[model samples]
Structures are given as C-alpha cells and as structure tokens.
Target: MRTSALREQRHPTLTPAAIGRAATLALHDELSLTPKPGLVTLIDRGSHDDMDAHTFMRSLFSLRRYFVQIAEAGLAGAEFDVLERFGIAAEARMRAATGGINTHRGAIFMLGLLCAAAGAVLREQDEAPRPADLQRALRRRWGDALAQRSQRTSTLPGGIAARRHGLRSASEEAALAFPVLFEAALPALSTALARGLTPQQARLDALFHIMAVLEDSNLAHRGGLAGLRFAQRTAQAFLDRGGVARPGGLQEAHAIAGEFVARRLSPGGAADTLAAACWITRVCGGS
Candidate 1:
C-alpha cells in the first residue's frame, strides 16, 4: 500500500474512555506483582502533586516498555519457558527492580504490543491492520509466536482504566455517560494516531481529555504524593527539575516541556509546551 493509504488504514477508532481504560490496564499490567484489574485505584493512590509530563509519560511508557521487552522474548509456551529460564533467581532480581509485574501473561501481552507496533510501522506493505487481515500480519511479525499466543492462556482485556477518576464531587449521571462519550471520542484518537502521532502523544491526549471532563464533573481527588513519585521516577530519564516551588502553574511549564518533545522529534519546530503542561497537571493530580 502507498504511504498515505497505509497511514489511513492503520488508524483505529479509540475513545478517551478506551484509551484511559488501556492506560489503566497497562499500568496494572506494568506494576502489579500479581495479575489484578484495579490499577486506576492504584494510580490514584500512588500519584502525587509535583509530578510533571515527562514523569507521567515515563510511568505509562516504562511499564509498556517492560511488557514489550518480555514479549519480544517469545509468545505461547515460550513465555513461561523464558520465565522459567529466568528461574527463581532471575525472577527475584526482576521483582526487586520492577514492582513484580513480570508475569507470563504480561510477557505475552507485551510481546503482542511489539507485534502490533512492528506491524503498524515496520512490516511489509500488505501486513497492516485490516478488517479482514489478522493472521497474515501476526504471521509476518511474530512468525511462530503468533500461533503460540493464540493457544496460550492469556488474553488482552477489552480496555483498562476506562473508569473515571476519584473526584471531590462525582455524579451518577456522568458515570453512566462513559459509553456514549467514548464512542464519540475514539475516532479523534484514531485520527491523531493516523497523523503519525506517537502512542505517547495519543495516550497523553486521551488522558488530558479525561482530566478535563472529570474536573468539569468534579469526579475525584488527586493522588497527591503517589502521583508525584510516579512523576519523579518517569522524569529520571530526561530533564529532571529536581523540585519545583509550584507545579500547578500549568501554562508556562507545559510550554517548555511540549517544546522539548517537539524539538526532540523535529528540531526546527516549536516545542509542545501546552501538552507538556497538561501532562504536568495530570502527574500533579489535577482534577
């Protein structure tokens, strides 16, 4: 397929709720020592007030990255085989470094993400996501691993963290609106994805939209300290401000961070400070 055609075809409709749910699932999938589904609560409990964009993005990306790495090791029976290869000693070491999320199914899911990313961007022209195409791309990307994953015990969730956050004042009416809202929102995500926005960008946009609605509805309280710590860990990779007097200034900070990302991606363009600031607000636990 031509480049434009390929781009158009790969864009899948994703709602804010779906993306949020995906983030939640990815977070739990990333952090849980054992498999569980309540990561949104975990993040609410863990995040703090001083966290920034890089920090927020890092937390999401870090777990997703770990998942991808393990998956790359294998699929199907190979996942457990690799974990067994890690043995008690290796698993202990991983647990110490990671929060104990390194499980067999997590490994398989991570591998699936790798296959998805590769098929989306790096595979042959014919191997993109299509209504009719599934096995072909899986075959090209994972080869034997695809077959193994199908037979394996794990299955990816429909969506994770689609739940609204904890808020100062939430309404029952808004709670019921999730389905309708996300159905409309997913296409925007798909559009952004088609524009070649990185998954990080797409995910970030979805988070921002959620925060906005939650704030409007007064749904939850900020995670405070946990949010900040998550931010600190995430920002360790890039520019770490160490500490800031007031992280809630929103406007100026996002300007700087967005620009930095933009400059990194396209050195000549202006940075995306606005988006970066929004990210900071999230890590800081804004409504």
Candidate 2:
C-alpha cells in the first residue's frame, strides 16, 4: 500500500475523549492480563506486597483527565515543559488516589507522551496517525527535551536502579522514542494476532517478549542485576518454547509467576510497555 493511503486506513480519528478512553482501556487491559510474571493482575499480585489490581484501577481512574488534557495540549502544539507539568500534576493525583502508592507513575510518563504525540500528529497531518507516525511525532516534537531530561539525576527507585546497574532509564527509552515498545512489544503482539491468537494470548506473548529484553528497573530494584538476568532468561525460554502458542503455555506462565513472586522480582517496566503496545494497537487499528 502507498504510505499515505496506508496511514489513512490504519489511523483512527483521534479526539481528546477518544485518546483518554483508549488510554484507560489500555491500562485496564494490562491490569486484566492474568499470570503476568512479576506483575499485578486481577488474579494475583505477582511480586509486590504494596499494591494490587484495585490499586491500579484507582490509579487509572485518577489519570483519565490527565490523558485527555495532555492530548489536548498536544493538539495545541504545547511544548515539552507544558506536558511535563501535566504529568507532574497527574502523578500527584495518582498518588493521592492510591493513598501514596506509585502505581501508574511510569504509565503517566510513557502513555502520556504517546497520547500527546498522537494528538500532535492528528492536528499536524489532519489525519489519523499510524504507529510509525506517532513514533516520528514523538521524536520530532520532543526528542531533544526527552534527551535532556534523561541526563538529569533521578531519585526514584527505578531511576536509581537504572543508573546503578547501567540500564537505560525510562527517560532514555522515551528520548529514543520507545524502541522496546515500537520494536519489540508491538511486533510480538501483532505477530501473535496474525497467527490467530486471541487478544489475551497476543498480549501475554507481547508481555513475555518485552520482559525478555527490557532493562526493567523494577526487577533491578527488587532483585538487582541477577534478578534482571533471571527474568530475561525466563522470558526468553518461554518464547523459545513458542510463547502462548505452545500447549500448556498458560500453565508454564503461571509457574513462572510463582517463581517471580518467590524471588520478589517484578517486571513493571515490561508491563508498562505491554500497555503502551495495546494503546498503539488500538490507535493504529492493528489487527
């Protein structure tokens, strides 16, 4: 297909309401995916004792307006500094909703940026944006600011862990336009769907694929480099066994969840990427 024609076919009409609804649905989808290794879901809290599925729901509820507002800001061609302020306020609301628990901090940053990018693309091109367009918009609009932000010192546990272990910080990932989400998670999810897997199965496959490669600071903070390595190996092994396509795959994932919980390792970063992948799929009309 021709490039512009393909974009027209793939991109959906994006409004602030549509963007917020999609963001909320994506986060809910992520929370509903069961047996996510070292992550929270409706059935279990994989590794963390502090939060659960309900906590995540509260965080989602709190950030609904934030997503819409940020998307609106993007449509208005707001600067990076403006978006950052929105994120900060949203984080405060999230913490308040969760009673000081940091459930959706990463999502506030990652999904917020993507939402803004989508809005910007819609306004600039006067058409729906494909995944690639969103990626390009992110870089073209705020890549320099993201890079500069990546250089600042971070006091958060995830940032500290990334720094201490030489893993890419979340800011670094964003500055590079979310290579893991665009390159790995979305592709895995799309391929699974193409192979006739259900949405849940596709998401699970995407989650494992992300866990295999993401330098998840959550794992590092909880179990350090050894823990991170163990997560990657486990995820890689699952994929080697054909991921969610294999017979008994769900059982194997459950087993892995058990192991991750026992080790106190949570792939929160990977989980966030999975959510972002879902958002891209929805926004871009990916089957």
Candidate 3:
C-alpha cells in the first residue's frame, strides 16, 4: 500500500479533506499515465490540440477545492441540487483556468460524484470506503436524481452526438450506478495487477477494457458511431493479443495511438472512467 493509503487505513476517521485529496491524486495518476491512445499526458498530447498537460493541470488545480467542498456536502447529507451547484461552480472555475477549454469536464462530474459518494459512505460507516460502498452510496443517495438527469436533453456536444448515434451518454451511465467502472474498469485493473503487471501497465489494461465496451459519448461526438466502434475493436484486439505485457505490446499500443491520432479519435470518456478506477483503487486500498 502507498504510505498515504497506509496512513488512511491506520486511521479509521477519514475526513472529507482526505477524501478530496484522494480524488485529486487519482486524477493526477490518470493524467500522468502516458501512451494513452488519443489522450493527453504529461509527455504527450495524443490527439487533442486545444488542451495539453498544462491545461489539464490548471483544471485539476481549480477543482481541488470543489472536491473537498462536495465531499463535505455529501457527508452533511446535502441534496442533489446542492451537489449540482457545486459542480456548476467547479466547471466555471475549470473553464476560467483553462481559458475555456473543456479539459477535465468529464472528470469533474465523474470524480466529483465519487468523492461525494465516498463522503456519504464515510458518514454512514465512519470506516474505510470500499469500491462497493462508494458505488452503493452514490446510487442510494442520488440514484433518483441521476435517473432524472439521464432523461434530460444534453446541449453538450458529446451528449448531442450520443443521442444522434444512439449511444449511451455519461449521464445515462451514471444513472445505472456506473456498471462499467465497477464491473469492467475496476475488475480489469485488479486482474492486471494480480497478474503482476506494473501499475502503469495495469492502468493501460483498465483503460482499454473500458474502451472496449463503453459507448463513449466523446468518441461518438468526435468520430461518430463508426469511430466509437473502430476504437472499441482496436482496444479489444490489443487486449486479446495480450495487452502491454506481450513482447510487442508497447509497439502495438503506439500503433493504436497513431491510428487514433490519424482518425482524430479521443476516448475522453474512457479516460475519465480510467481516472475513476484509479480513484477507487487509491481510496479503497485495492492493489
């Protein structure tokens, strides 16, 4: 376990501040992982030109306080509108920080909810927040609100594109308690680590697993439904070929990255999901 994680486990009284910090760390962990197909990293901007690592950093910093505040709200049993208000304020700060770029928008929603859920779980149990605990807490506290959210028409490009392509929007995924995050992403990460893959390699595994199945609105928006399918097939093929563990795995991954760049494909939703998985791992003390 990480030293900080150990400290968290040793001390059962985890606070909103600590939960907030974990969210930030998880986002950074996702950001720092390089060679992500069509995604930005500290070393490379795989597919995006509007924003890079610097832009992402500014957005990440801008939302640090938002996570803490939301966690506090969750712990205090604040209503869904209260959480939405926090998210709206955070999004404004993110836009301001990145000069109106949409960096971390997906993350702001996904991780924001998870952080609040973790807070709610802590309030109920005052114990360590497990992945299941957080997931259940999110659904129990905000399932109805999220269900209503899913039915609303989205003016966002991703949501519009998803509706056009007959794909699932992120809000829809949230309404279902994030089956992919809990069932697909987290399990893949755990399985990869169990197989002795390096943490970086494990994350790559998790990201691809998410892409293989997620009807990513970002992918649909950028590349249309065809693009979404193409990305999914490519990701599935890579995993079937043994992922980043095989001898030529890195080369194949780079090749996939090249393809995404050429196709202007950015699996932004998958990237966000990967970040959420990282958050779960860190906060839940998963290997």
Candidate No. with top lDDT = 2
lDDT of 1 by residue, 149-265 (tens): 334332222111113232212112122222212332233344445666555454334333333232221111122323323332333322234211125423433443443233221
lDDT against true structure, model 3: 0.91
Model 1 ranges off by over 4 Å: 1-94, 98-126, 130-186, 192-203, 210-287
For candidate 2, which ten residues in a row score worst on lDDT?
5-14
Q: Which stretches of candidate 3 lie over 4 Å from their true place?
A: 1-11
**Cα-based TM-score, every candidate:** 0.27, 0.95, 0.96
Indicate whether candidate 1 or candidate 2 has the larger lDDT. 2
**Better candidate number, 1 or 3, judged by lDDT:** 3
* Tens digit per residue, CA lDDT, model 3, 1-287: 69979876565677899888988988898899878899999988888888889999999999999999999999999999999999999999999999999998898899999989988998788667778898899899999999999999999999999899888899999999899999999999999999999999999988999999999999998898899999999999999999998998988888898999999999999999999998888777764
Q: What is the lDDT, from 0 to 100, of the residue 28 in candidate 1?
A: 36
Q: What local distance difference test score does each model get?
A: 0.30, 0.92, 0.91
Write one digit per residue (lDDT tens) for candidate 2, span 209-243.
Answer: 99999999989999999999999999999999988
Worst 10 contiguous positions by lDDT, candidate 1: 265-274
RMSD of 3: 2.8
Better of 1 and 3 by TM-score: 3
The ten-residue window of minimal lDDT in model 3 covers 6-15
